[model samples]
Target chain A: MAQRTVLFVLFDQVQSLDVTGPVEVFAGAERHTPGTYRIGTASLDGAPVRTSSGLTVVPDRSLADVPDPDTLVVPGGQGTRSPDPRLTDWLRAHGPHVRRLVSVCTGAALLAGAGLLDGRRATTHWAYCDRLAREYPAVDVDPDPIYVRDGHVATSAGVTSGIDLALALVEEDLGRDTALTIARHLVVFLRRPGNQAQFSAQLAAQTARREPLRELQRWITEHPGADLGVETLAARAGLSPRHFARAFRAETGTTPGRYVDRIRLEHARRLLEDTGDGVEQVSRASGYGTPEGMRRAFVKALGTSPAEYRRRFRPAPAH
Target chain B: MAQRTVLFVLFDQVQSLDVTGPVEVFAGAERHTPGTYRIGTASLDGAPVRTSSGLTVVPDRSLADVPDPDTLVVPGGQGTRSPDPRLTDWLRAHGPHVRRLVSVCTGAALLAGAGLLDGRRATTHWAYCDRLAREYPAVDVDPDPIYVRDGHVATSAGVTSGIDLALALVEEDLGRDTALTIARHLVVFLRRPGNQAQFSAQLAAQTARREPLRELQRWITEHPGADLGVETLAARAGLSPRHFARAFRAETGTTPGRYVDRIRLEHARRLLEDTGDGVEQVSRASGYGTPEGMRRAFVKALGTSPAEYRRRFRPAPAH
Candidate 1:
């Protein structure tokens, strides 16, 4: 079979992994199945592009000289703070010809800025998801999944998620077996199913900023199996449930129910990581009434199950 | 609190991720806990070093001018093929003063070449494991876990596994909660609690190269649930059990029992990844007589359980 050319666009301050992670995936796939992909790196002026981490990348061709690619990869970094018109203009002009379009980390912002994702459901780095949605209101920003694909365009969240996106692309191009081989070679998870929320549990926990609410939040985290309903929490804080819920949302930017869910999930994760407890034990210990309830919460909050969570995070003994 | 200095040594043709993955982990840790780590990059000549992927990295300082680091990191790449004496000499001379000595991927080769890994039980990228063991017989190359730490000297396998090593380092320096938070932010597995053998199942399957033996190997993979004892396999191959076992080992570099174990493990992994079957069902289907038997196999081989494996690698529903 003829190789599909995967052209990676480089720019000043681009995240090194945003480019290299996907590149390595494709390169690894090629090693597993020869003639699978032809990888290339390109820049605007054929000059060395300095990455955010002080690394410089030499492109295979300038945007003007490079041929139309089967796949186009745009990586994100601090460089996304200032979108280059030349690059965005080029993407707008050439994006349609490309069979697959991808953005890693905050690169989705560039695609949004280029008007390619005006009505597309896309994502970016978790830290920048809110800004991307705010700046490009036309783009349907869903800041959850490691990567999202609407039609031929795909956008991944954060730095490492780029590898997940690339692995998915490899699975799509080759078969599951081939993709698994490449993933094994890379020594990454065969596939990190679900969205990117697992990475944001900490961010969610720190939302409550008020003094009483902050104290309550700490208590809830420390005692996950406790009755953490709005009424109980409000009573603990010496306020009415209705007033406490409203104030909590106003201060934390999230509802009381959502806050509890996040805290419960965080506690559940800690239990799963530190212990070898069964799902039922973990669910009850982490505040859920039943294993089924906790399973639902895991799926809804982290897009995985309690049993699965323990499997992925449980610490192994030192060899 | 004073931050510890983490010095990453860069060289020409270094694997980009081998440097970036760990660097990002420390950087993320810094964001989570300010004054945690001060990151620095250094090179032998102080000139910009070109990475294997055609990227160039600028070092913060030359080795000659840089002060002794609290933690020293060495990343492997094609550069390891030709050891630079200056870098190895520096490692030998100053390695003891560094609080922690670390290597990522084939960087173990560099460390071993410097005689620092002498008699230390270490590991490297799986593909290079045998060669690393052969080249430096003095070093105890295990070639399994994502990372290994003998005293303050740490080493990791492959490129992305560097992140796992760095996370472990962070967990050691900070606490589990902080490391878990950093992992969540990075959207990586809080800790991928298994060895590299999980990733090398396919590699294990392809060891036999001769015709009839290779054909028999394929048959074993196809019938993983079958009785794969040496007696049955020898009968199938029209040879005495004793002769068959010896020939199989000589031809494939592994005993029949070990080969059968690998094939069964691979089959189990595939079933875990592709289906939602219960552990008992998967065990039976994958040739194990009981769930406990399979569980022991999983724990022994991958340092994880069958249920956990299924949770991690199960296919996501199509978007």
Candidate 2:
């Protein structure tokens, strides 16, 4: 395969991690498979840019000096909050031409401002998701997955998720074995622990504003093994089941049953990862009456049997 | 409580993440609880140090300008392999006087060379652990844990373990709640992981150089659910039970029974983290006869029941 030129764009106040995590992963891959990646960093002008954490980065080349690179990575930080028009103007003009256009964290904001992500399903740091959606009505901002790849334009969530997205790109280019090797070298999961596909977005999406409902939500999360049927929860909350379900949906954006399912799955997944517990015990603890119930949930939601899921996602003992 | 001042020593060729990961965590904490931690970065002469990744970092002040900091942090990279004598000399003179002394990645090498870790238990990047032990026999290097706390001086493994160690310090100084809040803001785990105490060290420690034995080791790791009795394994290896047991111990340094236990525990933990499988199924799949058997192993090894372990280690549905 021919070498791919990967250029990282540097700006003032960029979060250093948004740059290093991916850079390090790709760099590790390059070390293992030399001539696969030719990585470089550039700024709008050939000057030093200070990271949000107060580290200053001196760029290798000017943005104008390098044109139409295979991959252009834009990292986000405070600088993206109020960016230079020249930078966005540059992105607006050159983004579509690049083979791969990527953004880390709030760098999505810059891309949206430049119309690169217009009508694209994208994601950013969870904290900034709502703002990105609100500000750029044309951009489909997903606040859930660690990263999103909409065609050739890809975006990732806060800080470390950049590492995840970068690994995905590497895996695409060099296959799973190469990506896995680099991840092991970095001591990070090739895929982070747990099912990112059925990520905890539903439960993290909303919390009831009412104090009693909020307390109930916490209770449900904390005690996944407890009887979480609508009637039992309704009695505890001093409301009729019908009334409780309505209030929960109105306040939290999901029905009580759905929320409970999400929590139980999360609980079971944690047990599998952290403990040497049996599937039956994990199922019971996660409120599944039978092991089969948990298996069905795992298959339906995550598209893998519980055992296979564990095998795939869990760290292969440090060796 | 008086605000503790944390000073990070920066040097040329330092890993940027080694510096930023901890800085971002502390910076997030400061954002939440103002006046709690005053964090700064400095170099021997406050010059702009270029990181191994080629990013330039300008230190906040000169090392001579800051004396007797409450906490001193030395981050590692390629730079630590051949450090300036002035930096090591400074650390040797000033390390003990600080309330807390910390090292990340290969930074421990510098500390060990300076005699700061001469009689203290410590750790560094996993790949470097053996080298660190071989080079500095006086430094009681324990390579198992992600991070080690030897009195007031703490050392951590690799790039990301620094984040884990930093969070531990924040938890010690502030509280679980404060540290947890910062972690959530940064999209990282507060405690990071399931029984980090029962980390997969045994499996990581040795891989038999002999091809057949190495293949057997891989088999044991991959098929934790298999019947792995000495007789069964001996049959698979085409040897008598006694001979197989002896050869396995000699080659792997650990008995087959011990290796199997480690692999089983690791497999069970992965299921708990990634799947919605029930505990009984998880136990059976992990080759434990019953949920009770799995529970016993978990308690003996991780000191937590399966249900409790899942609760403690699982990510709270991400809100």
Highest-DockQ candidate: 1
By summed lDDT, the worst window of 10 consecutive residues in model 1 chain A runs over A198-207
lDDT of 1 by residue, A1-319 (tens): 6799999998998877788888888887887888889888888998888776555556777999999899999999889888789998999999878999999999998888889998899998887888888899899999888889999999999899999889889888897787777777778876675568766654433456668888888898788898888888999999999999888888888987887887788788778888888888988998898999998988997887777677656664564
The TM-score of predicted model 1 comes to 0.84
User: After best superposition, candidate 1 residue B121: deviation in angstroms?
Assistant: 0.5
lDDT of each: 0.84, 0.81
lDDT per residue for candidate 2 within A1-319, as digits (tens), equals 8999888999998988889888888887888898898888989997989887666777888888896789889999889999999999999999999999999988899999999998899999877887899899999987767788999999988778888889889888897667766665555655554333432223356689987999999999999999999999999899999999999999998999999998898888777756778899989999998999999998777655677555433432421
- In candidate 1, position B179 carries an lDDT of 81
A-chain TM-score of every model: 0.82, 0.72
Residue A108 of model 1 has an lDDT of: 91
Identify the leading candidate in terms of lDDT.
1
Candidate 2: stretches off by over 4 Å:
A195-319, B194-319
Looking at model 2, residue B96 earns an lDDT score of 89
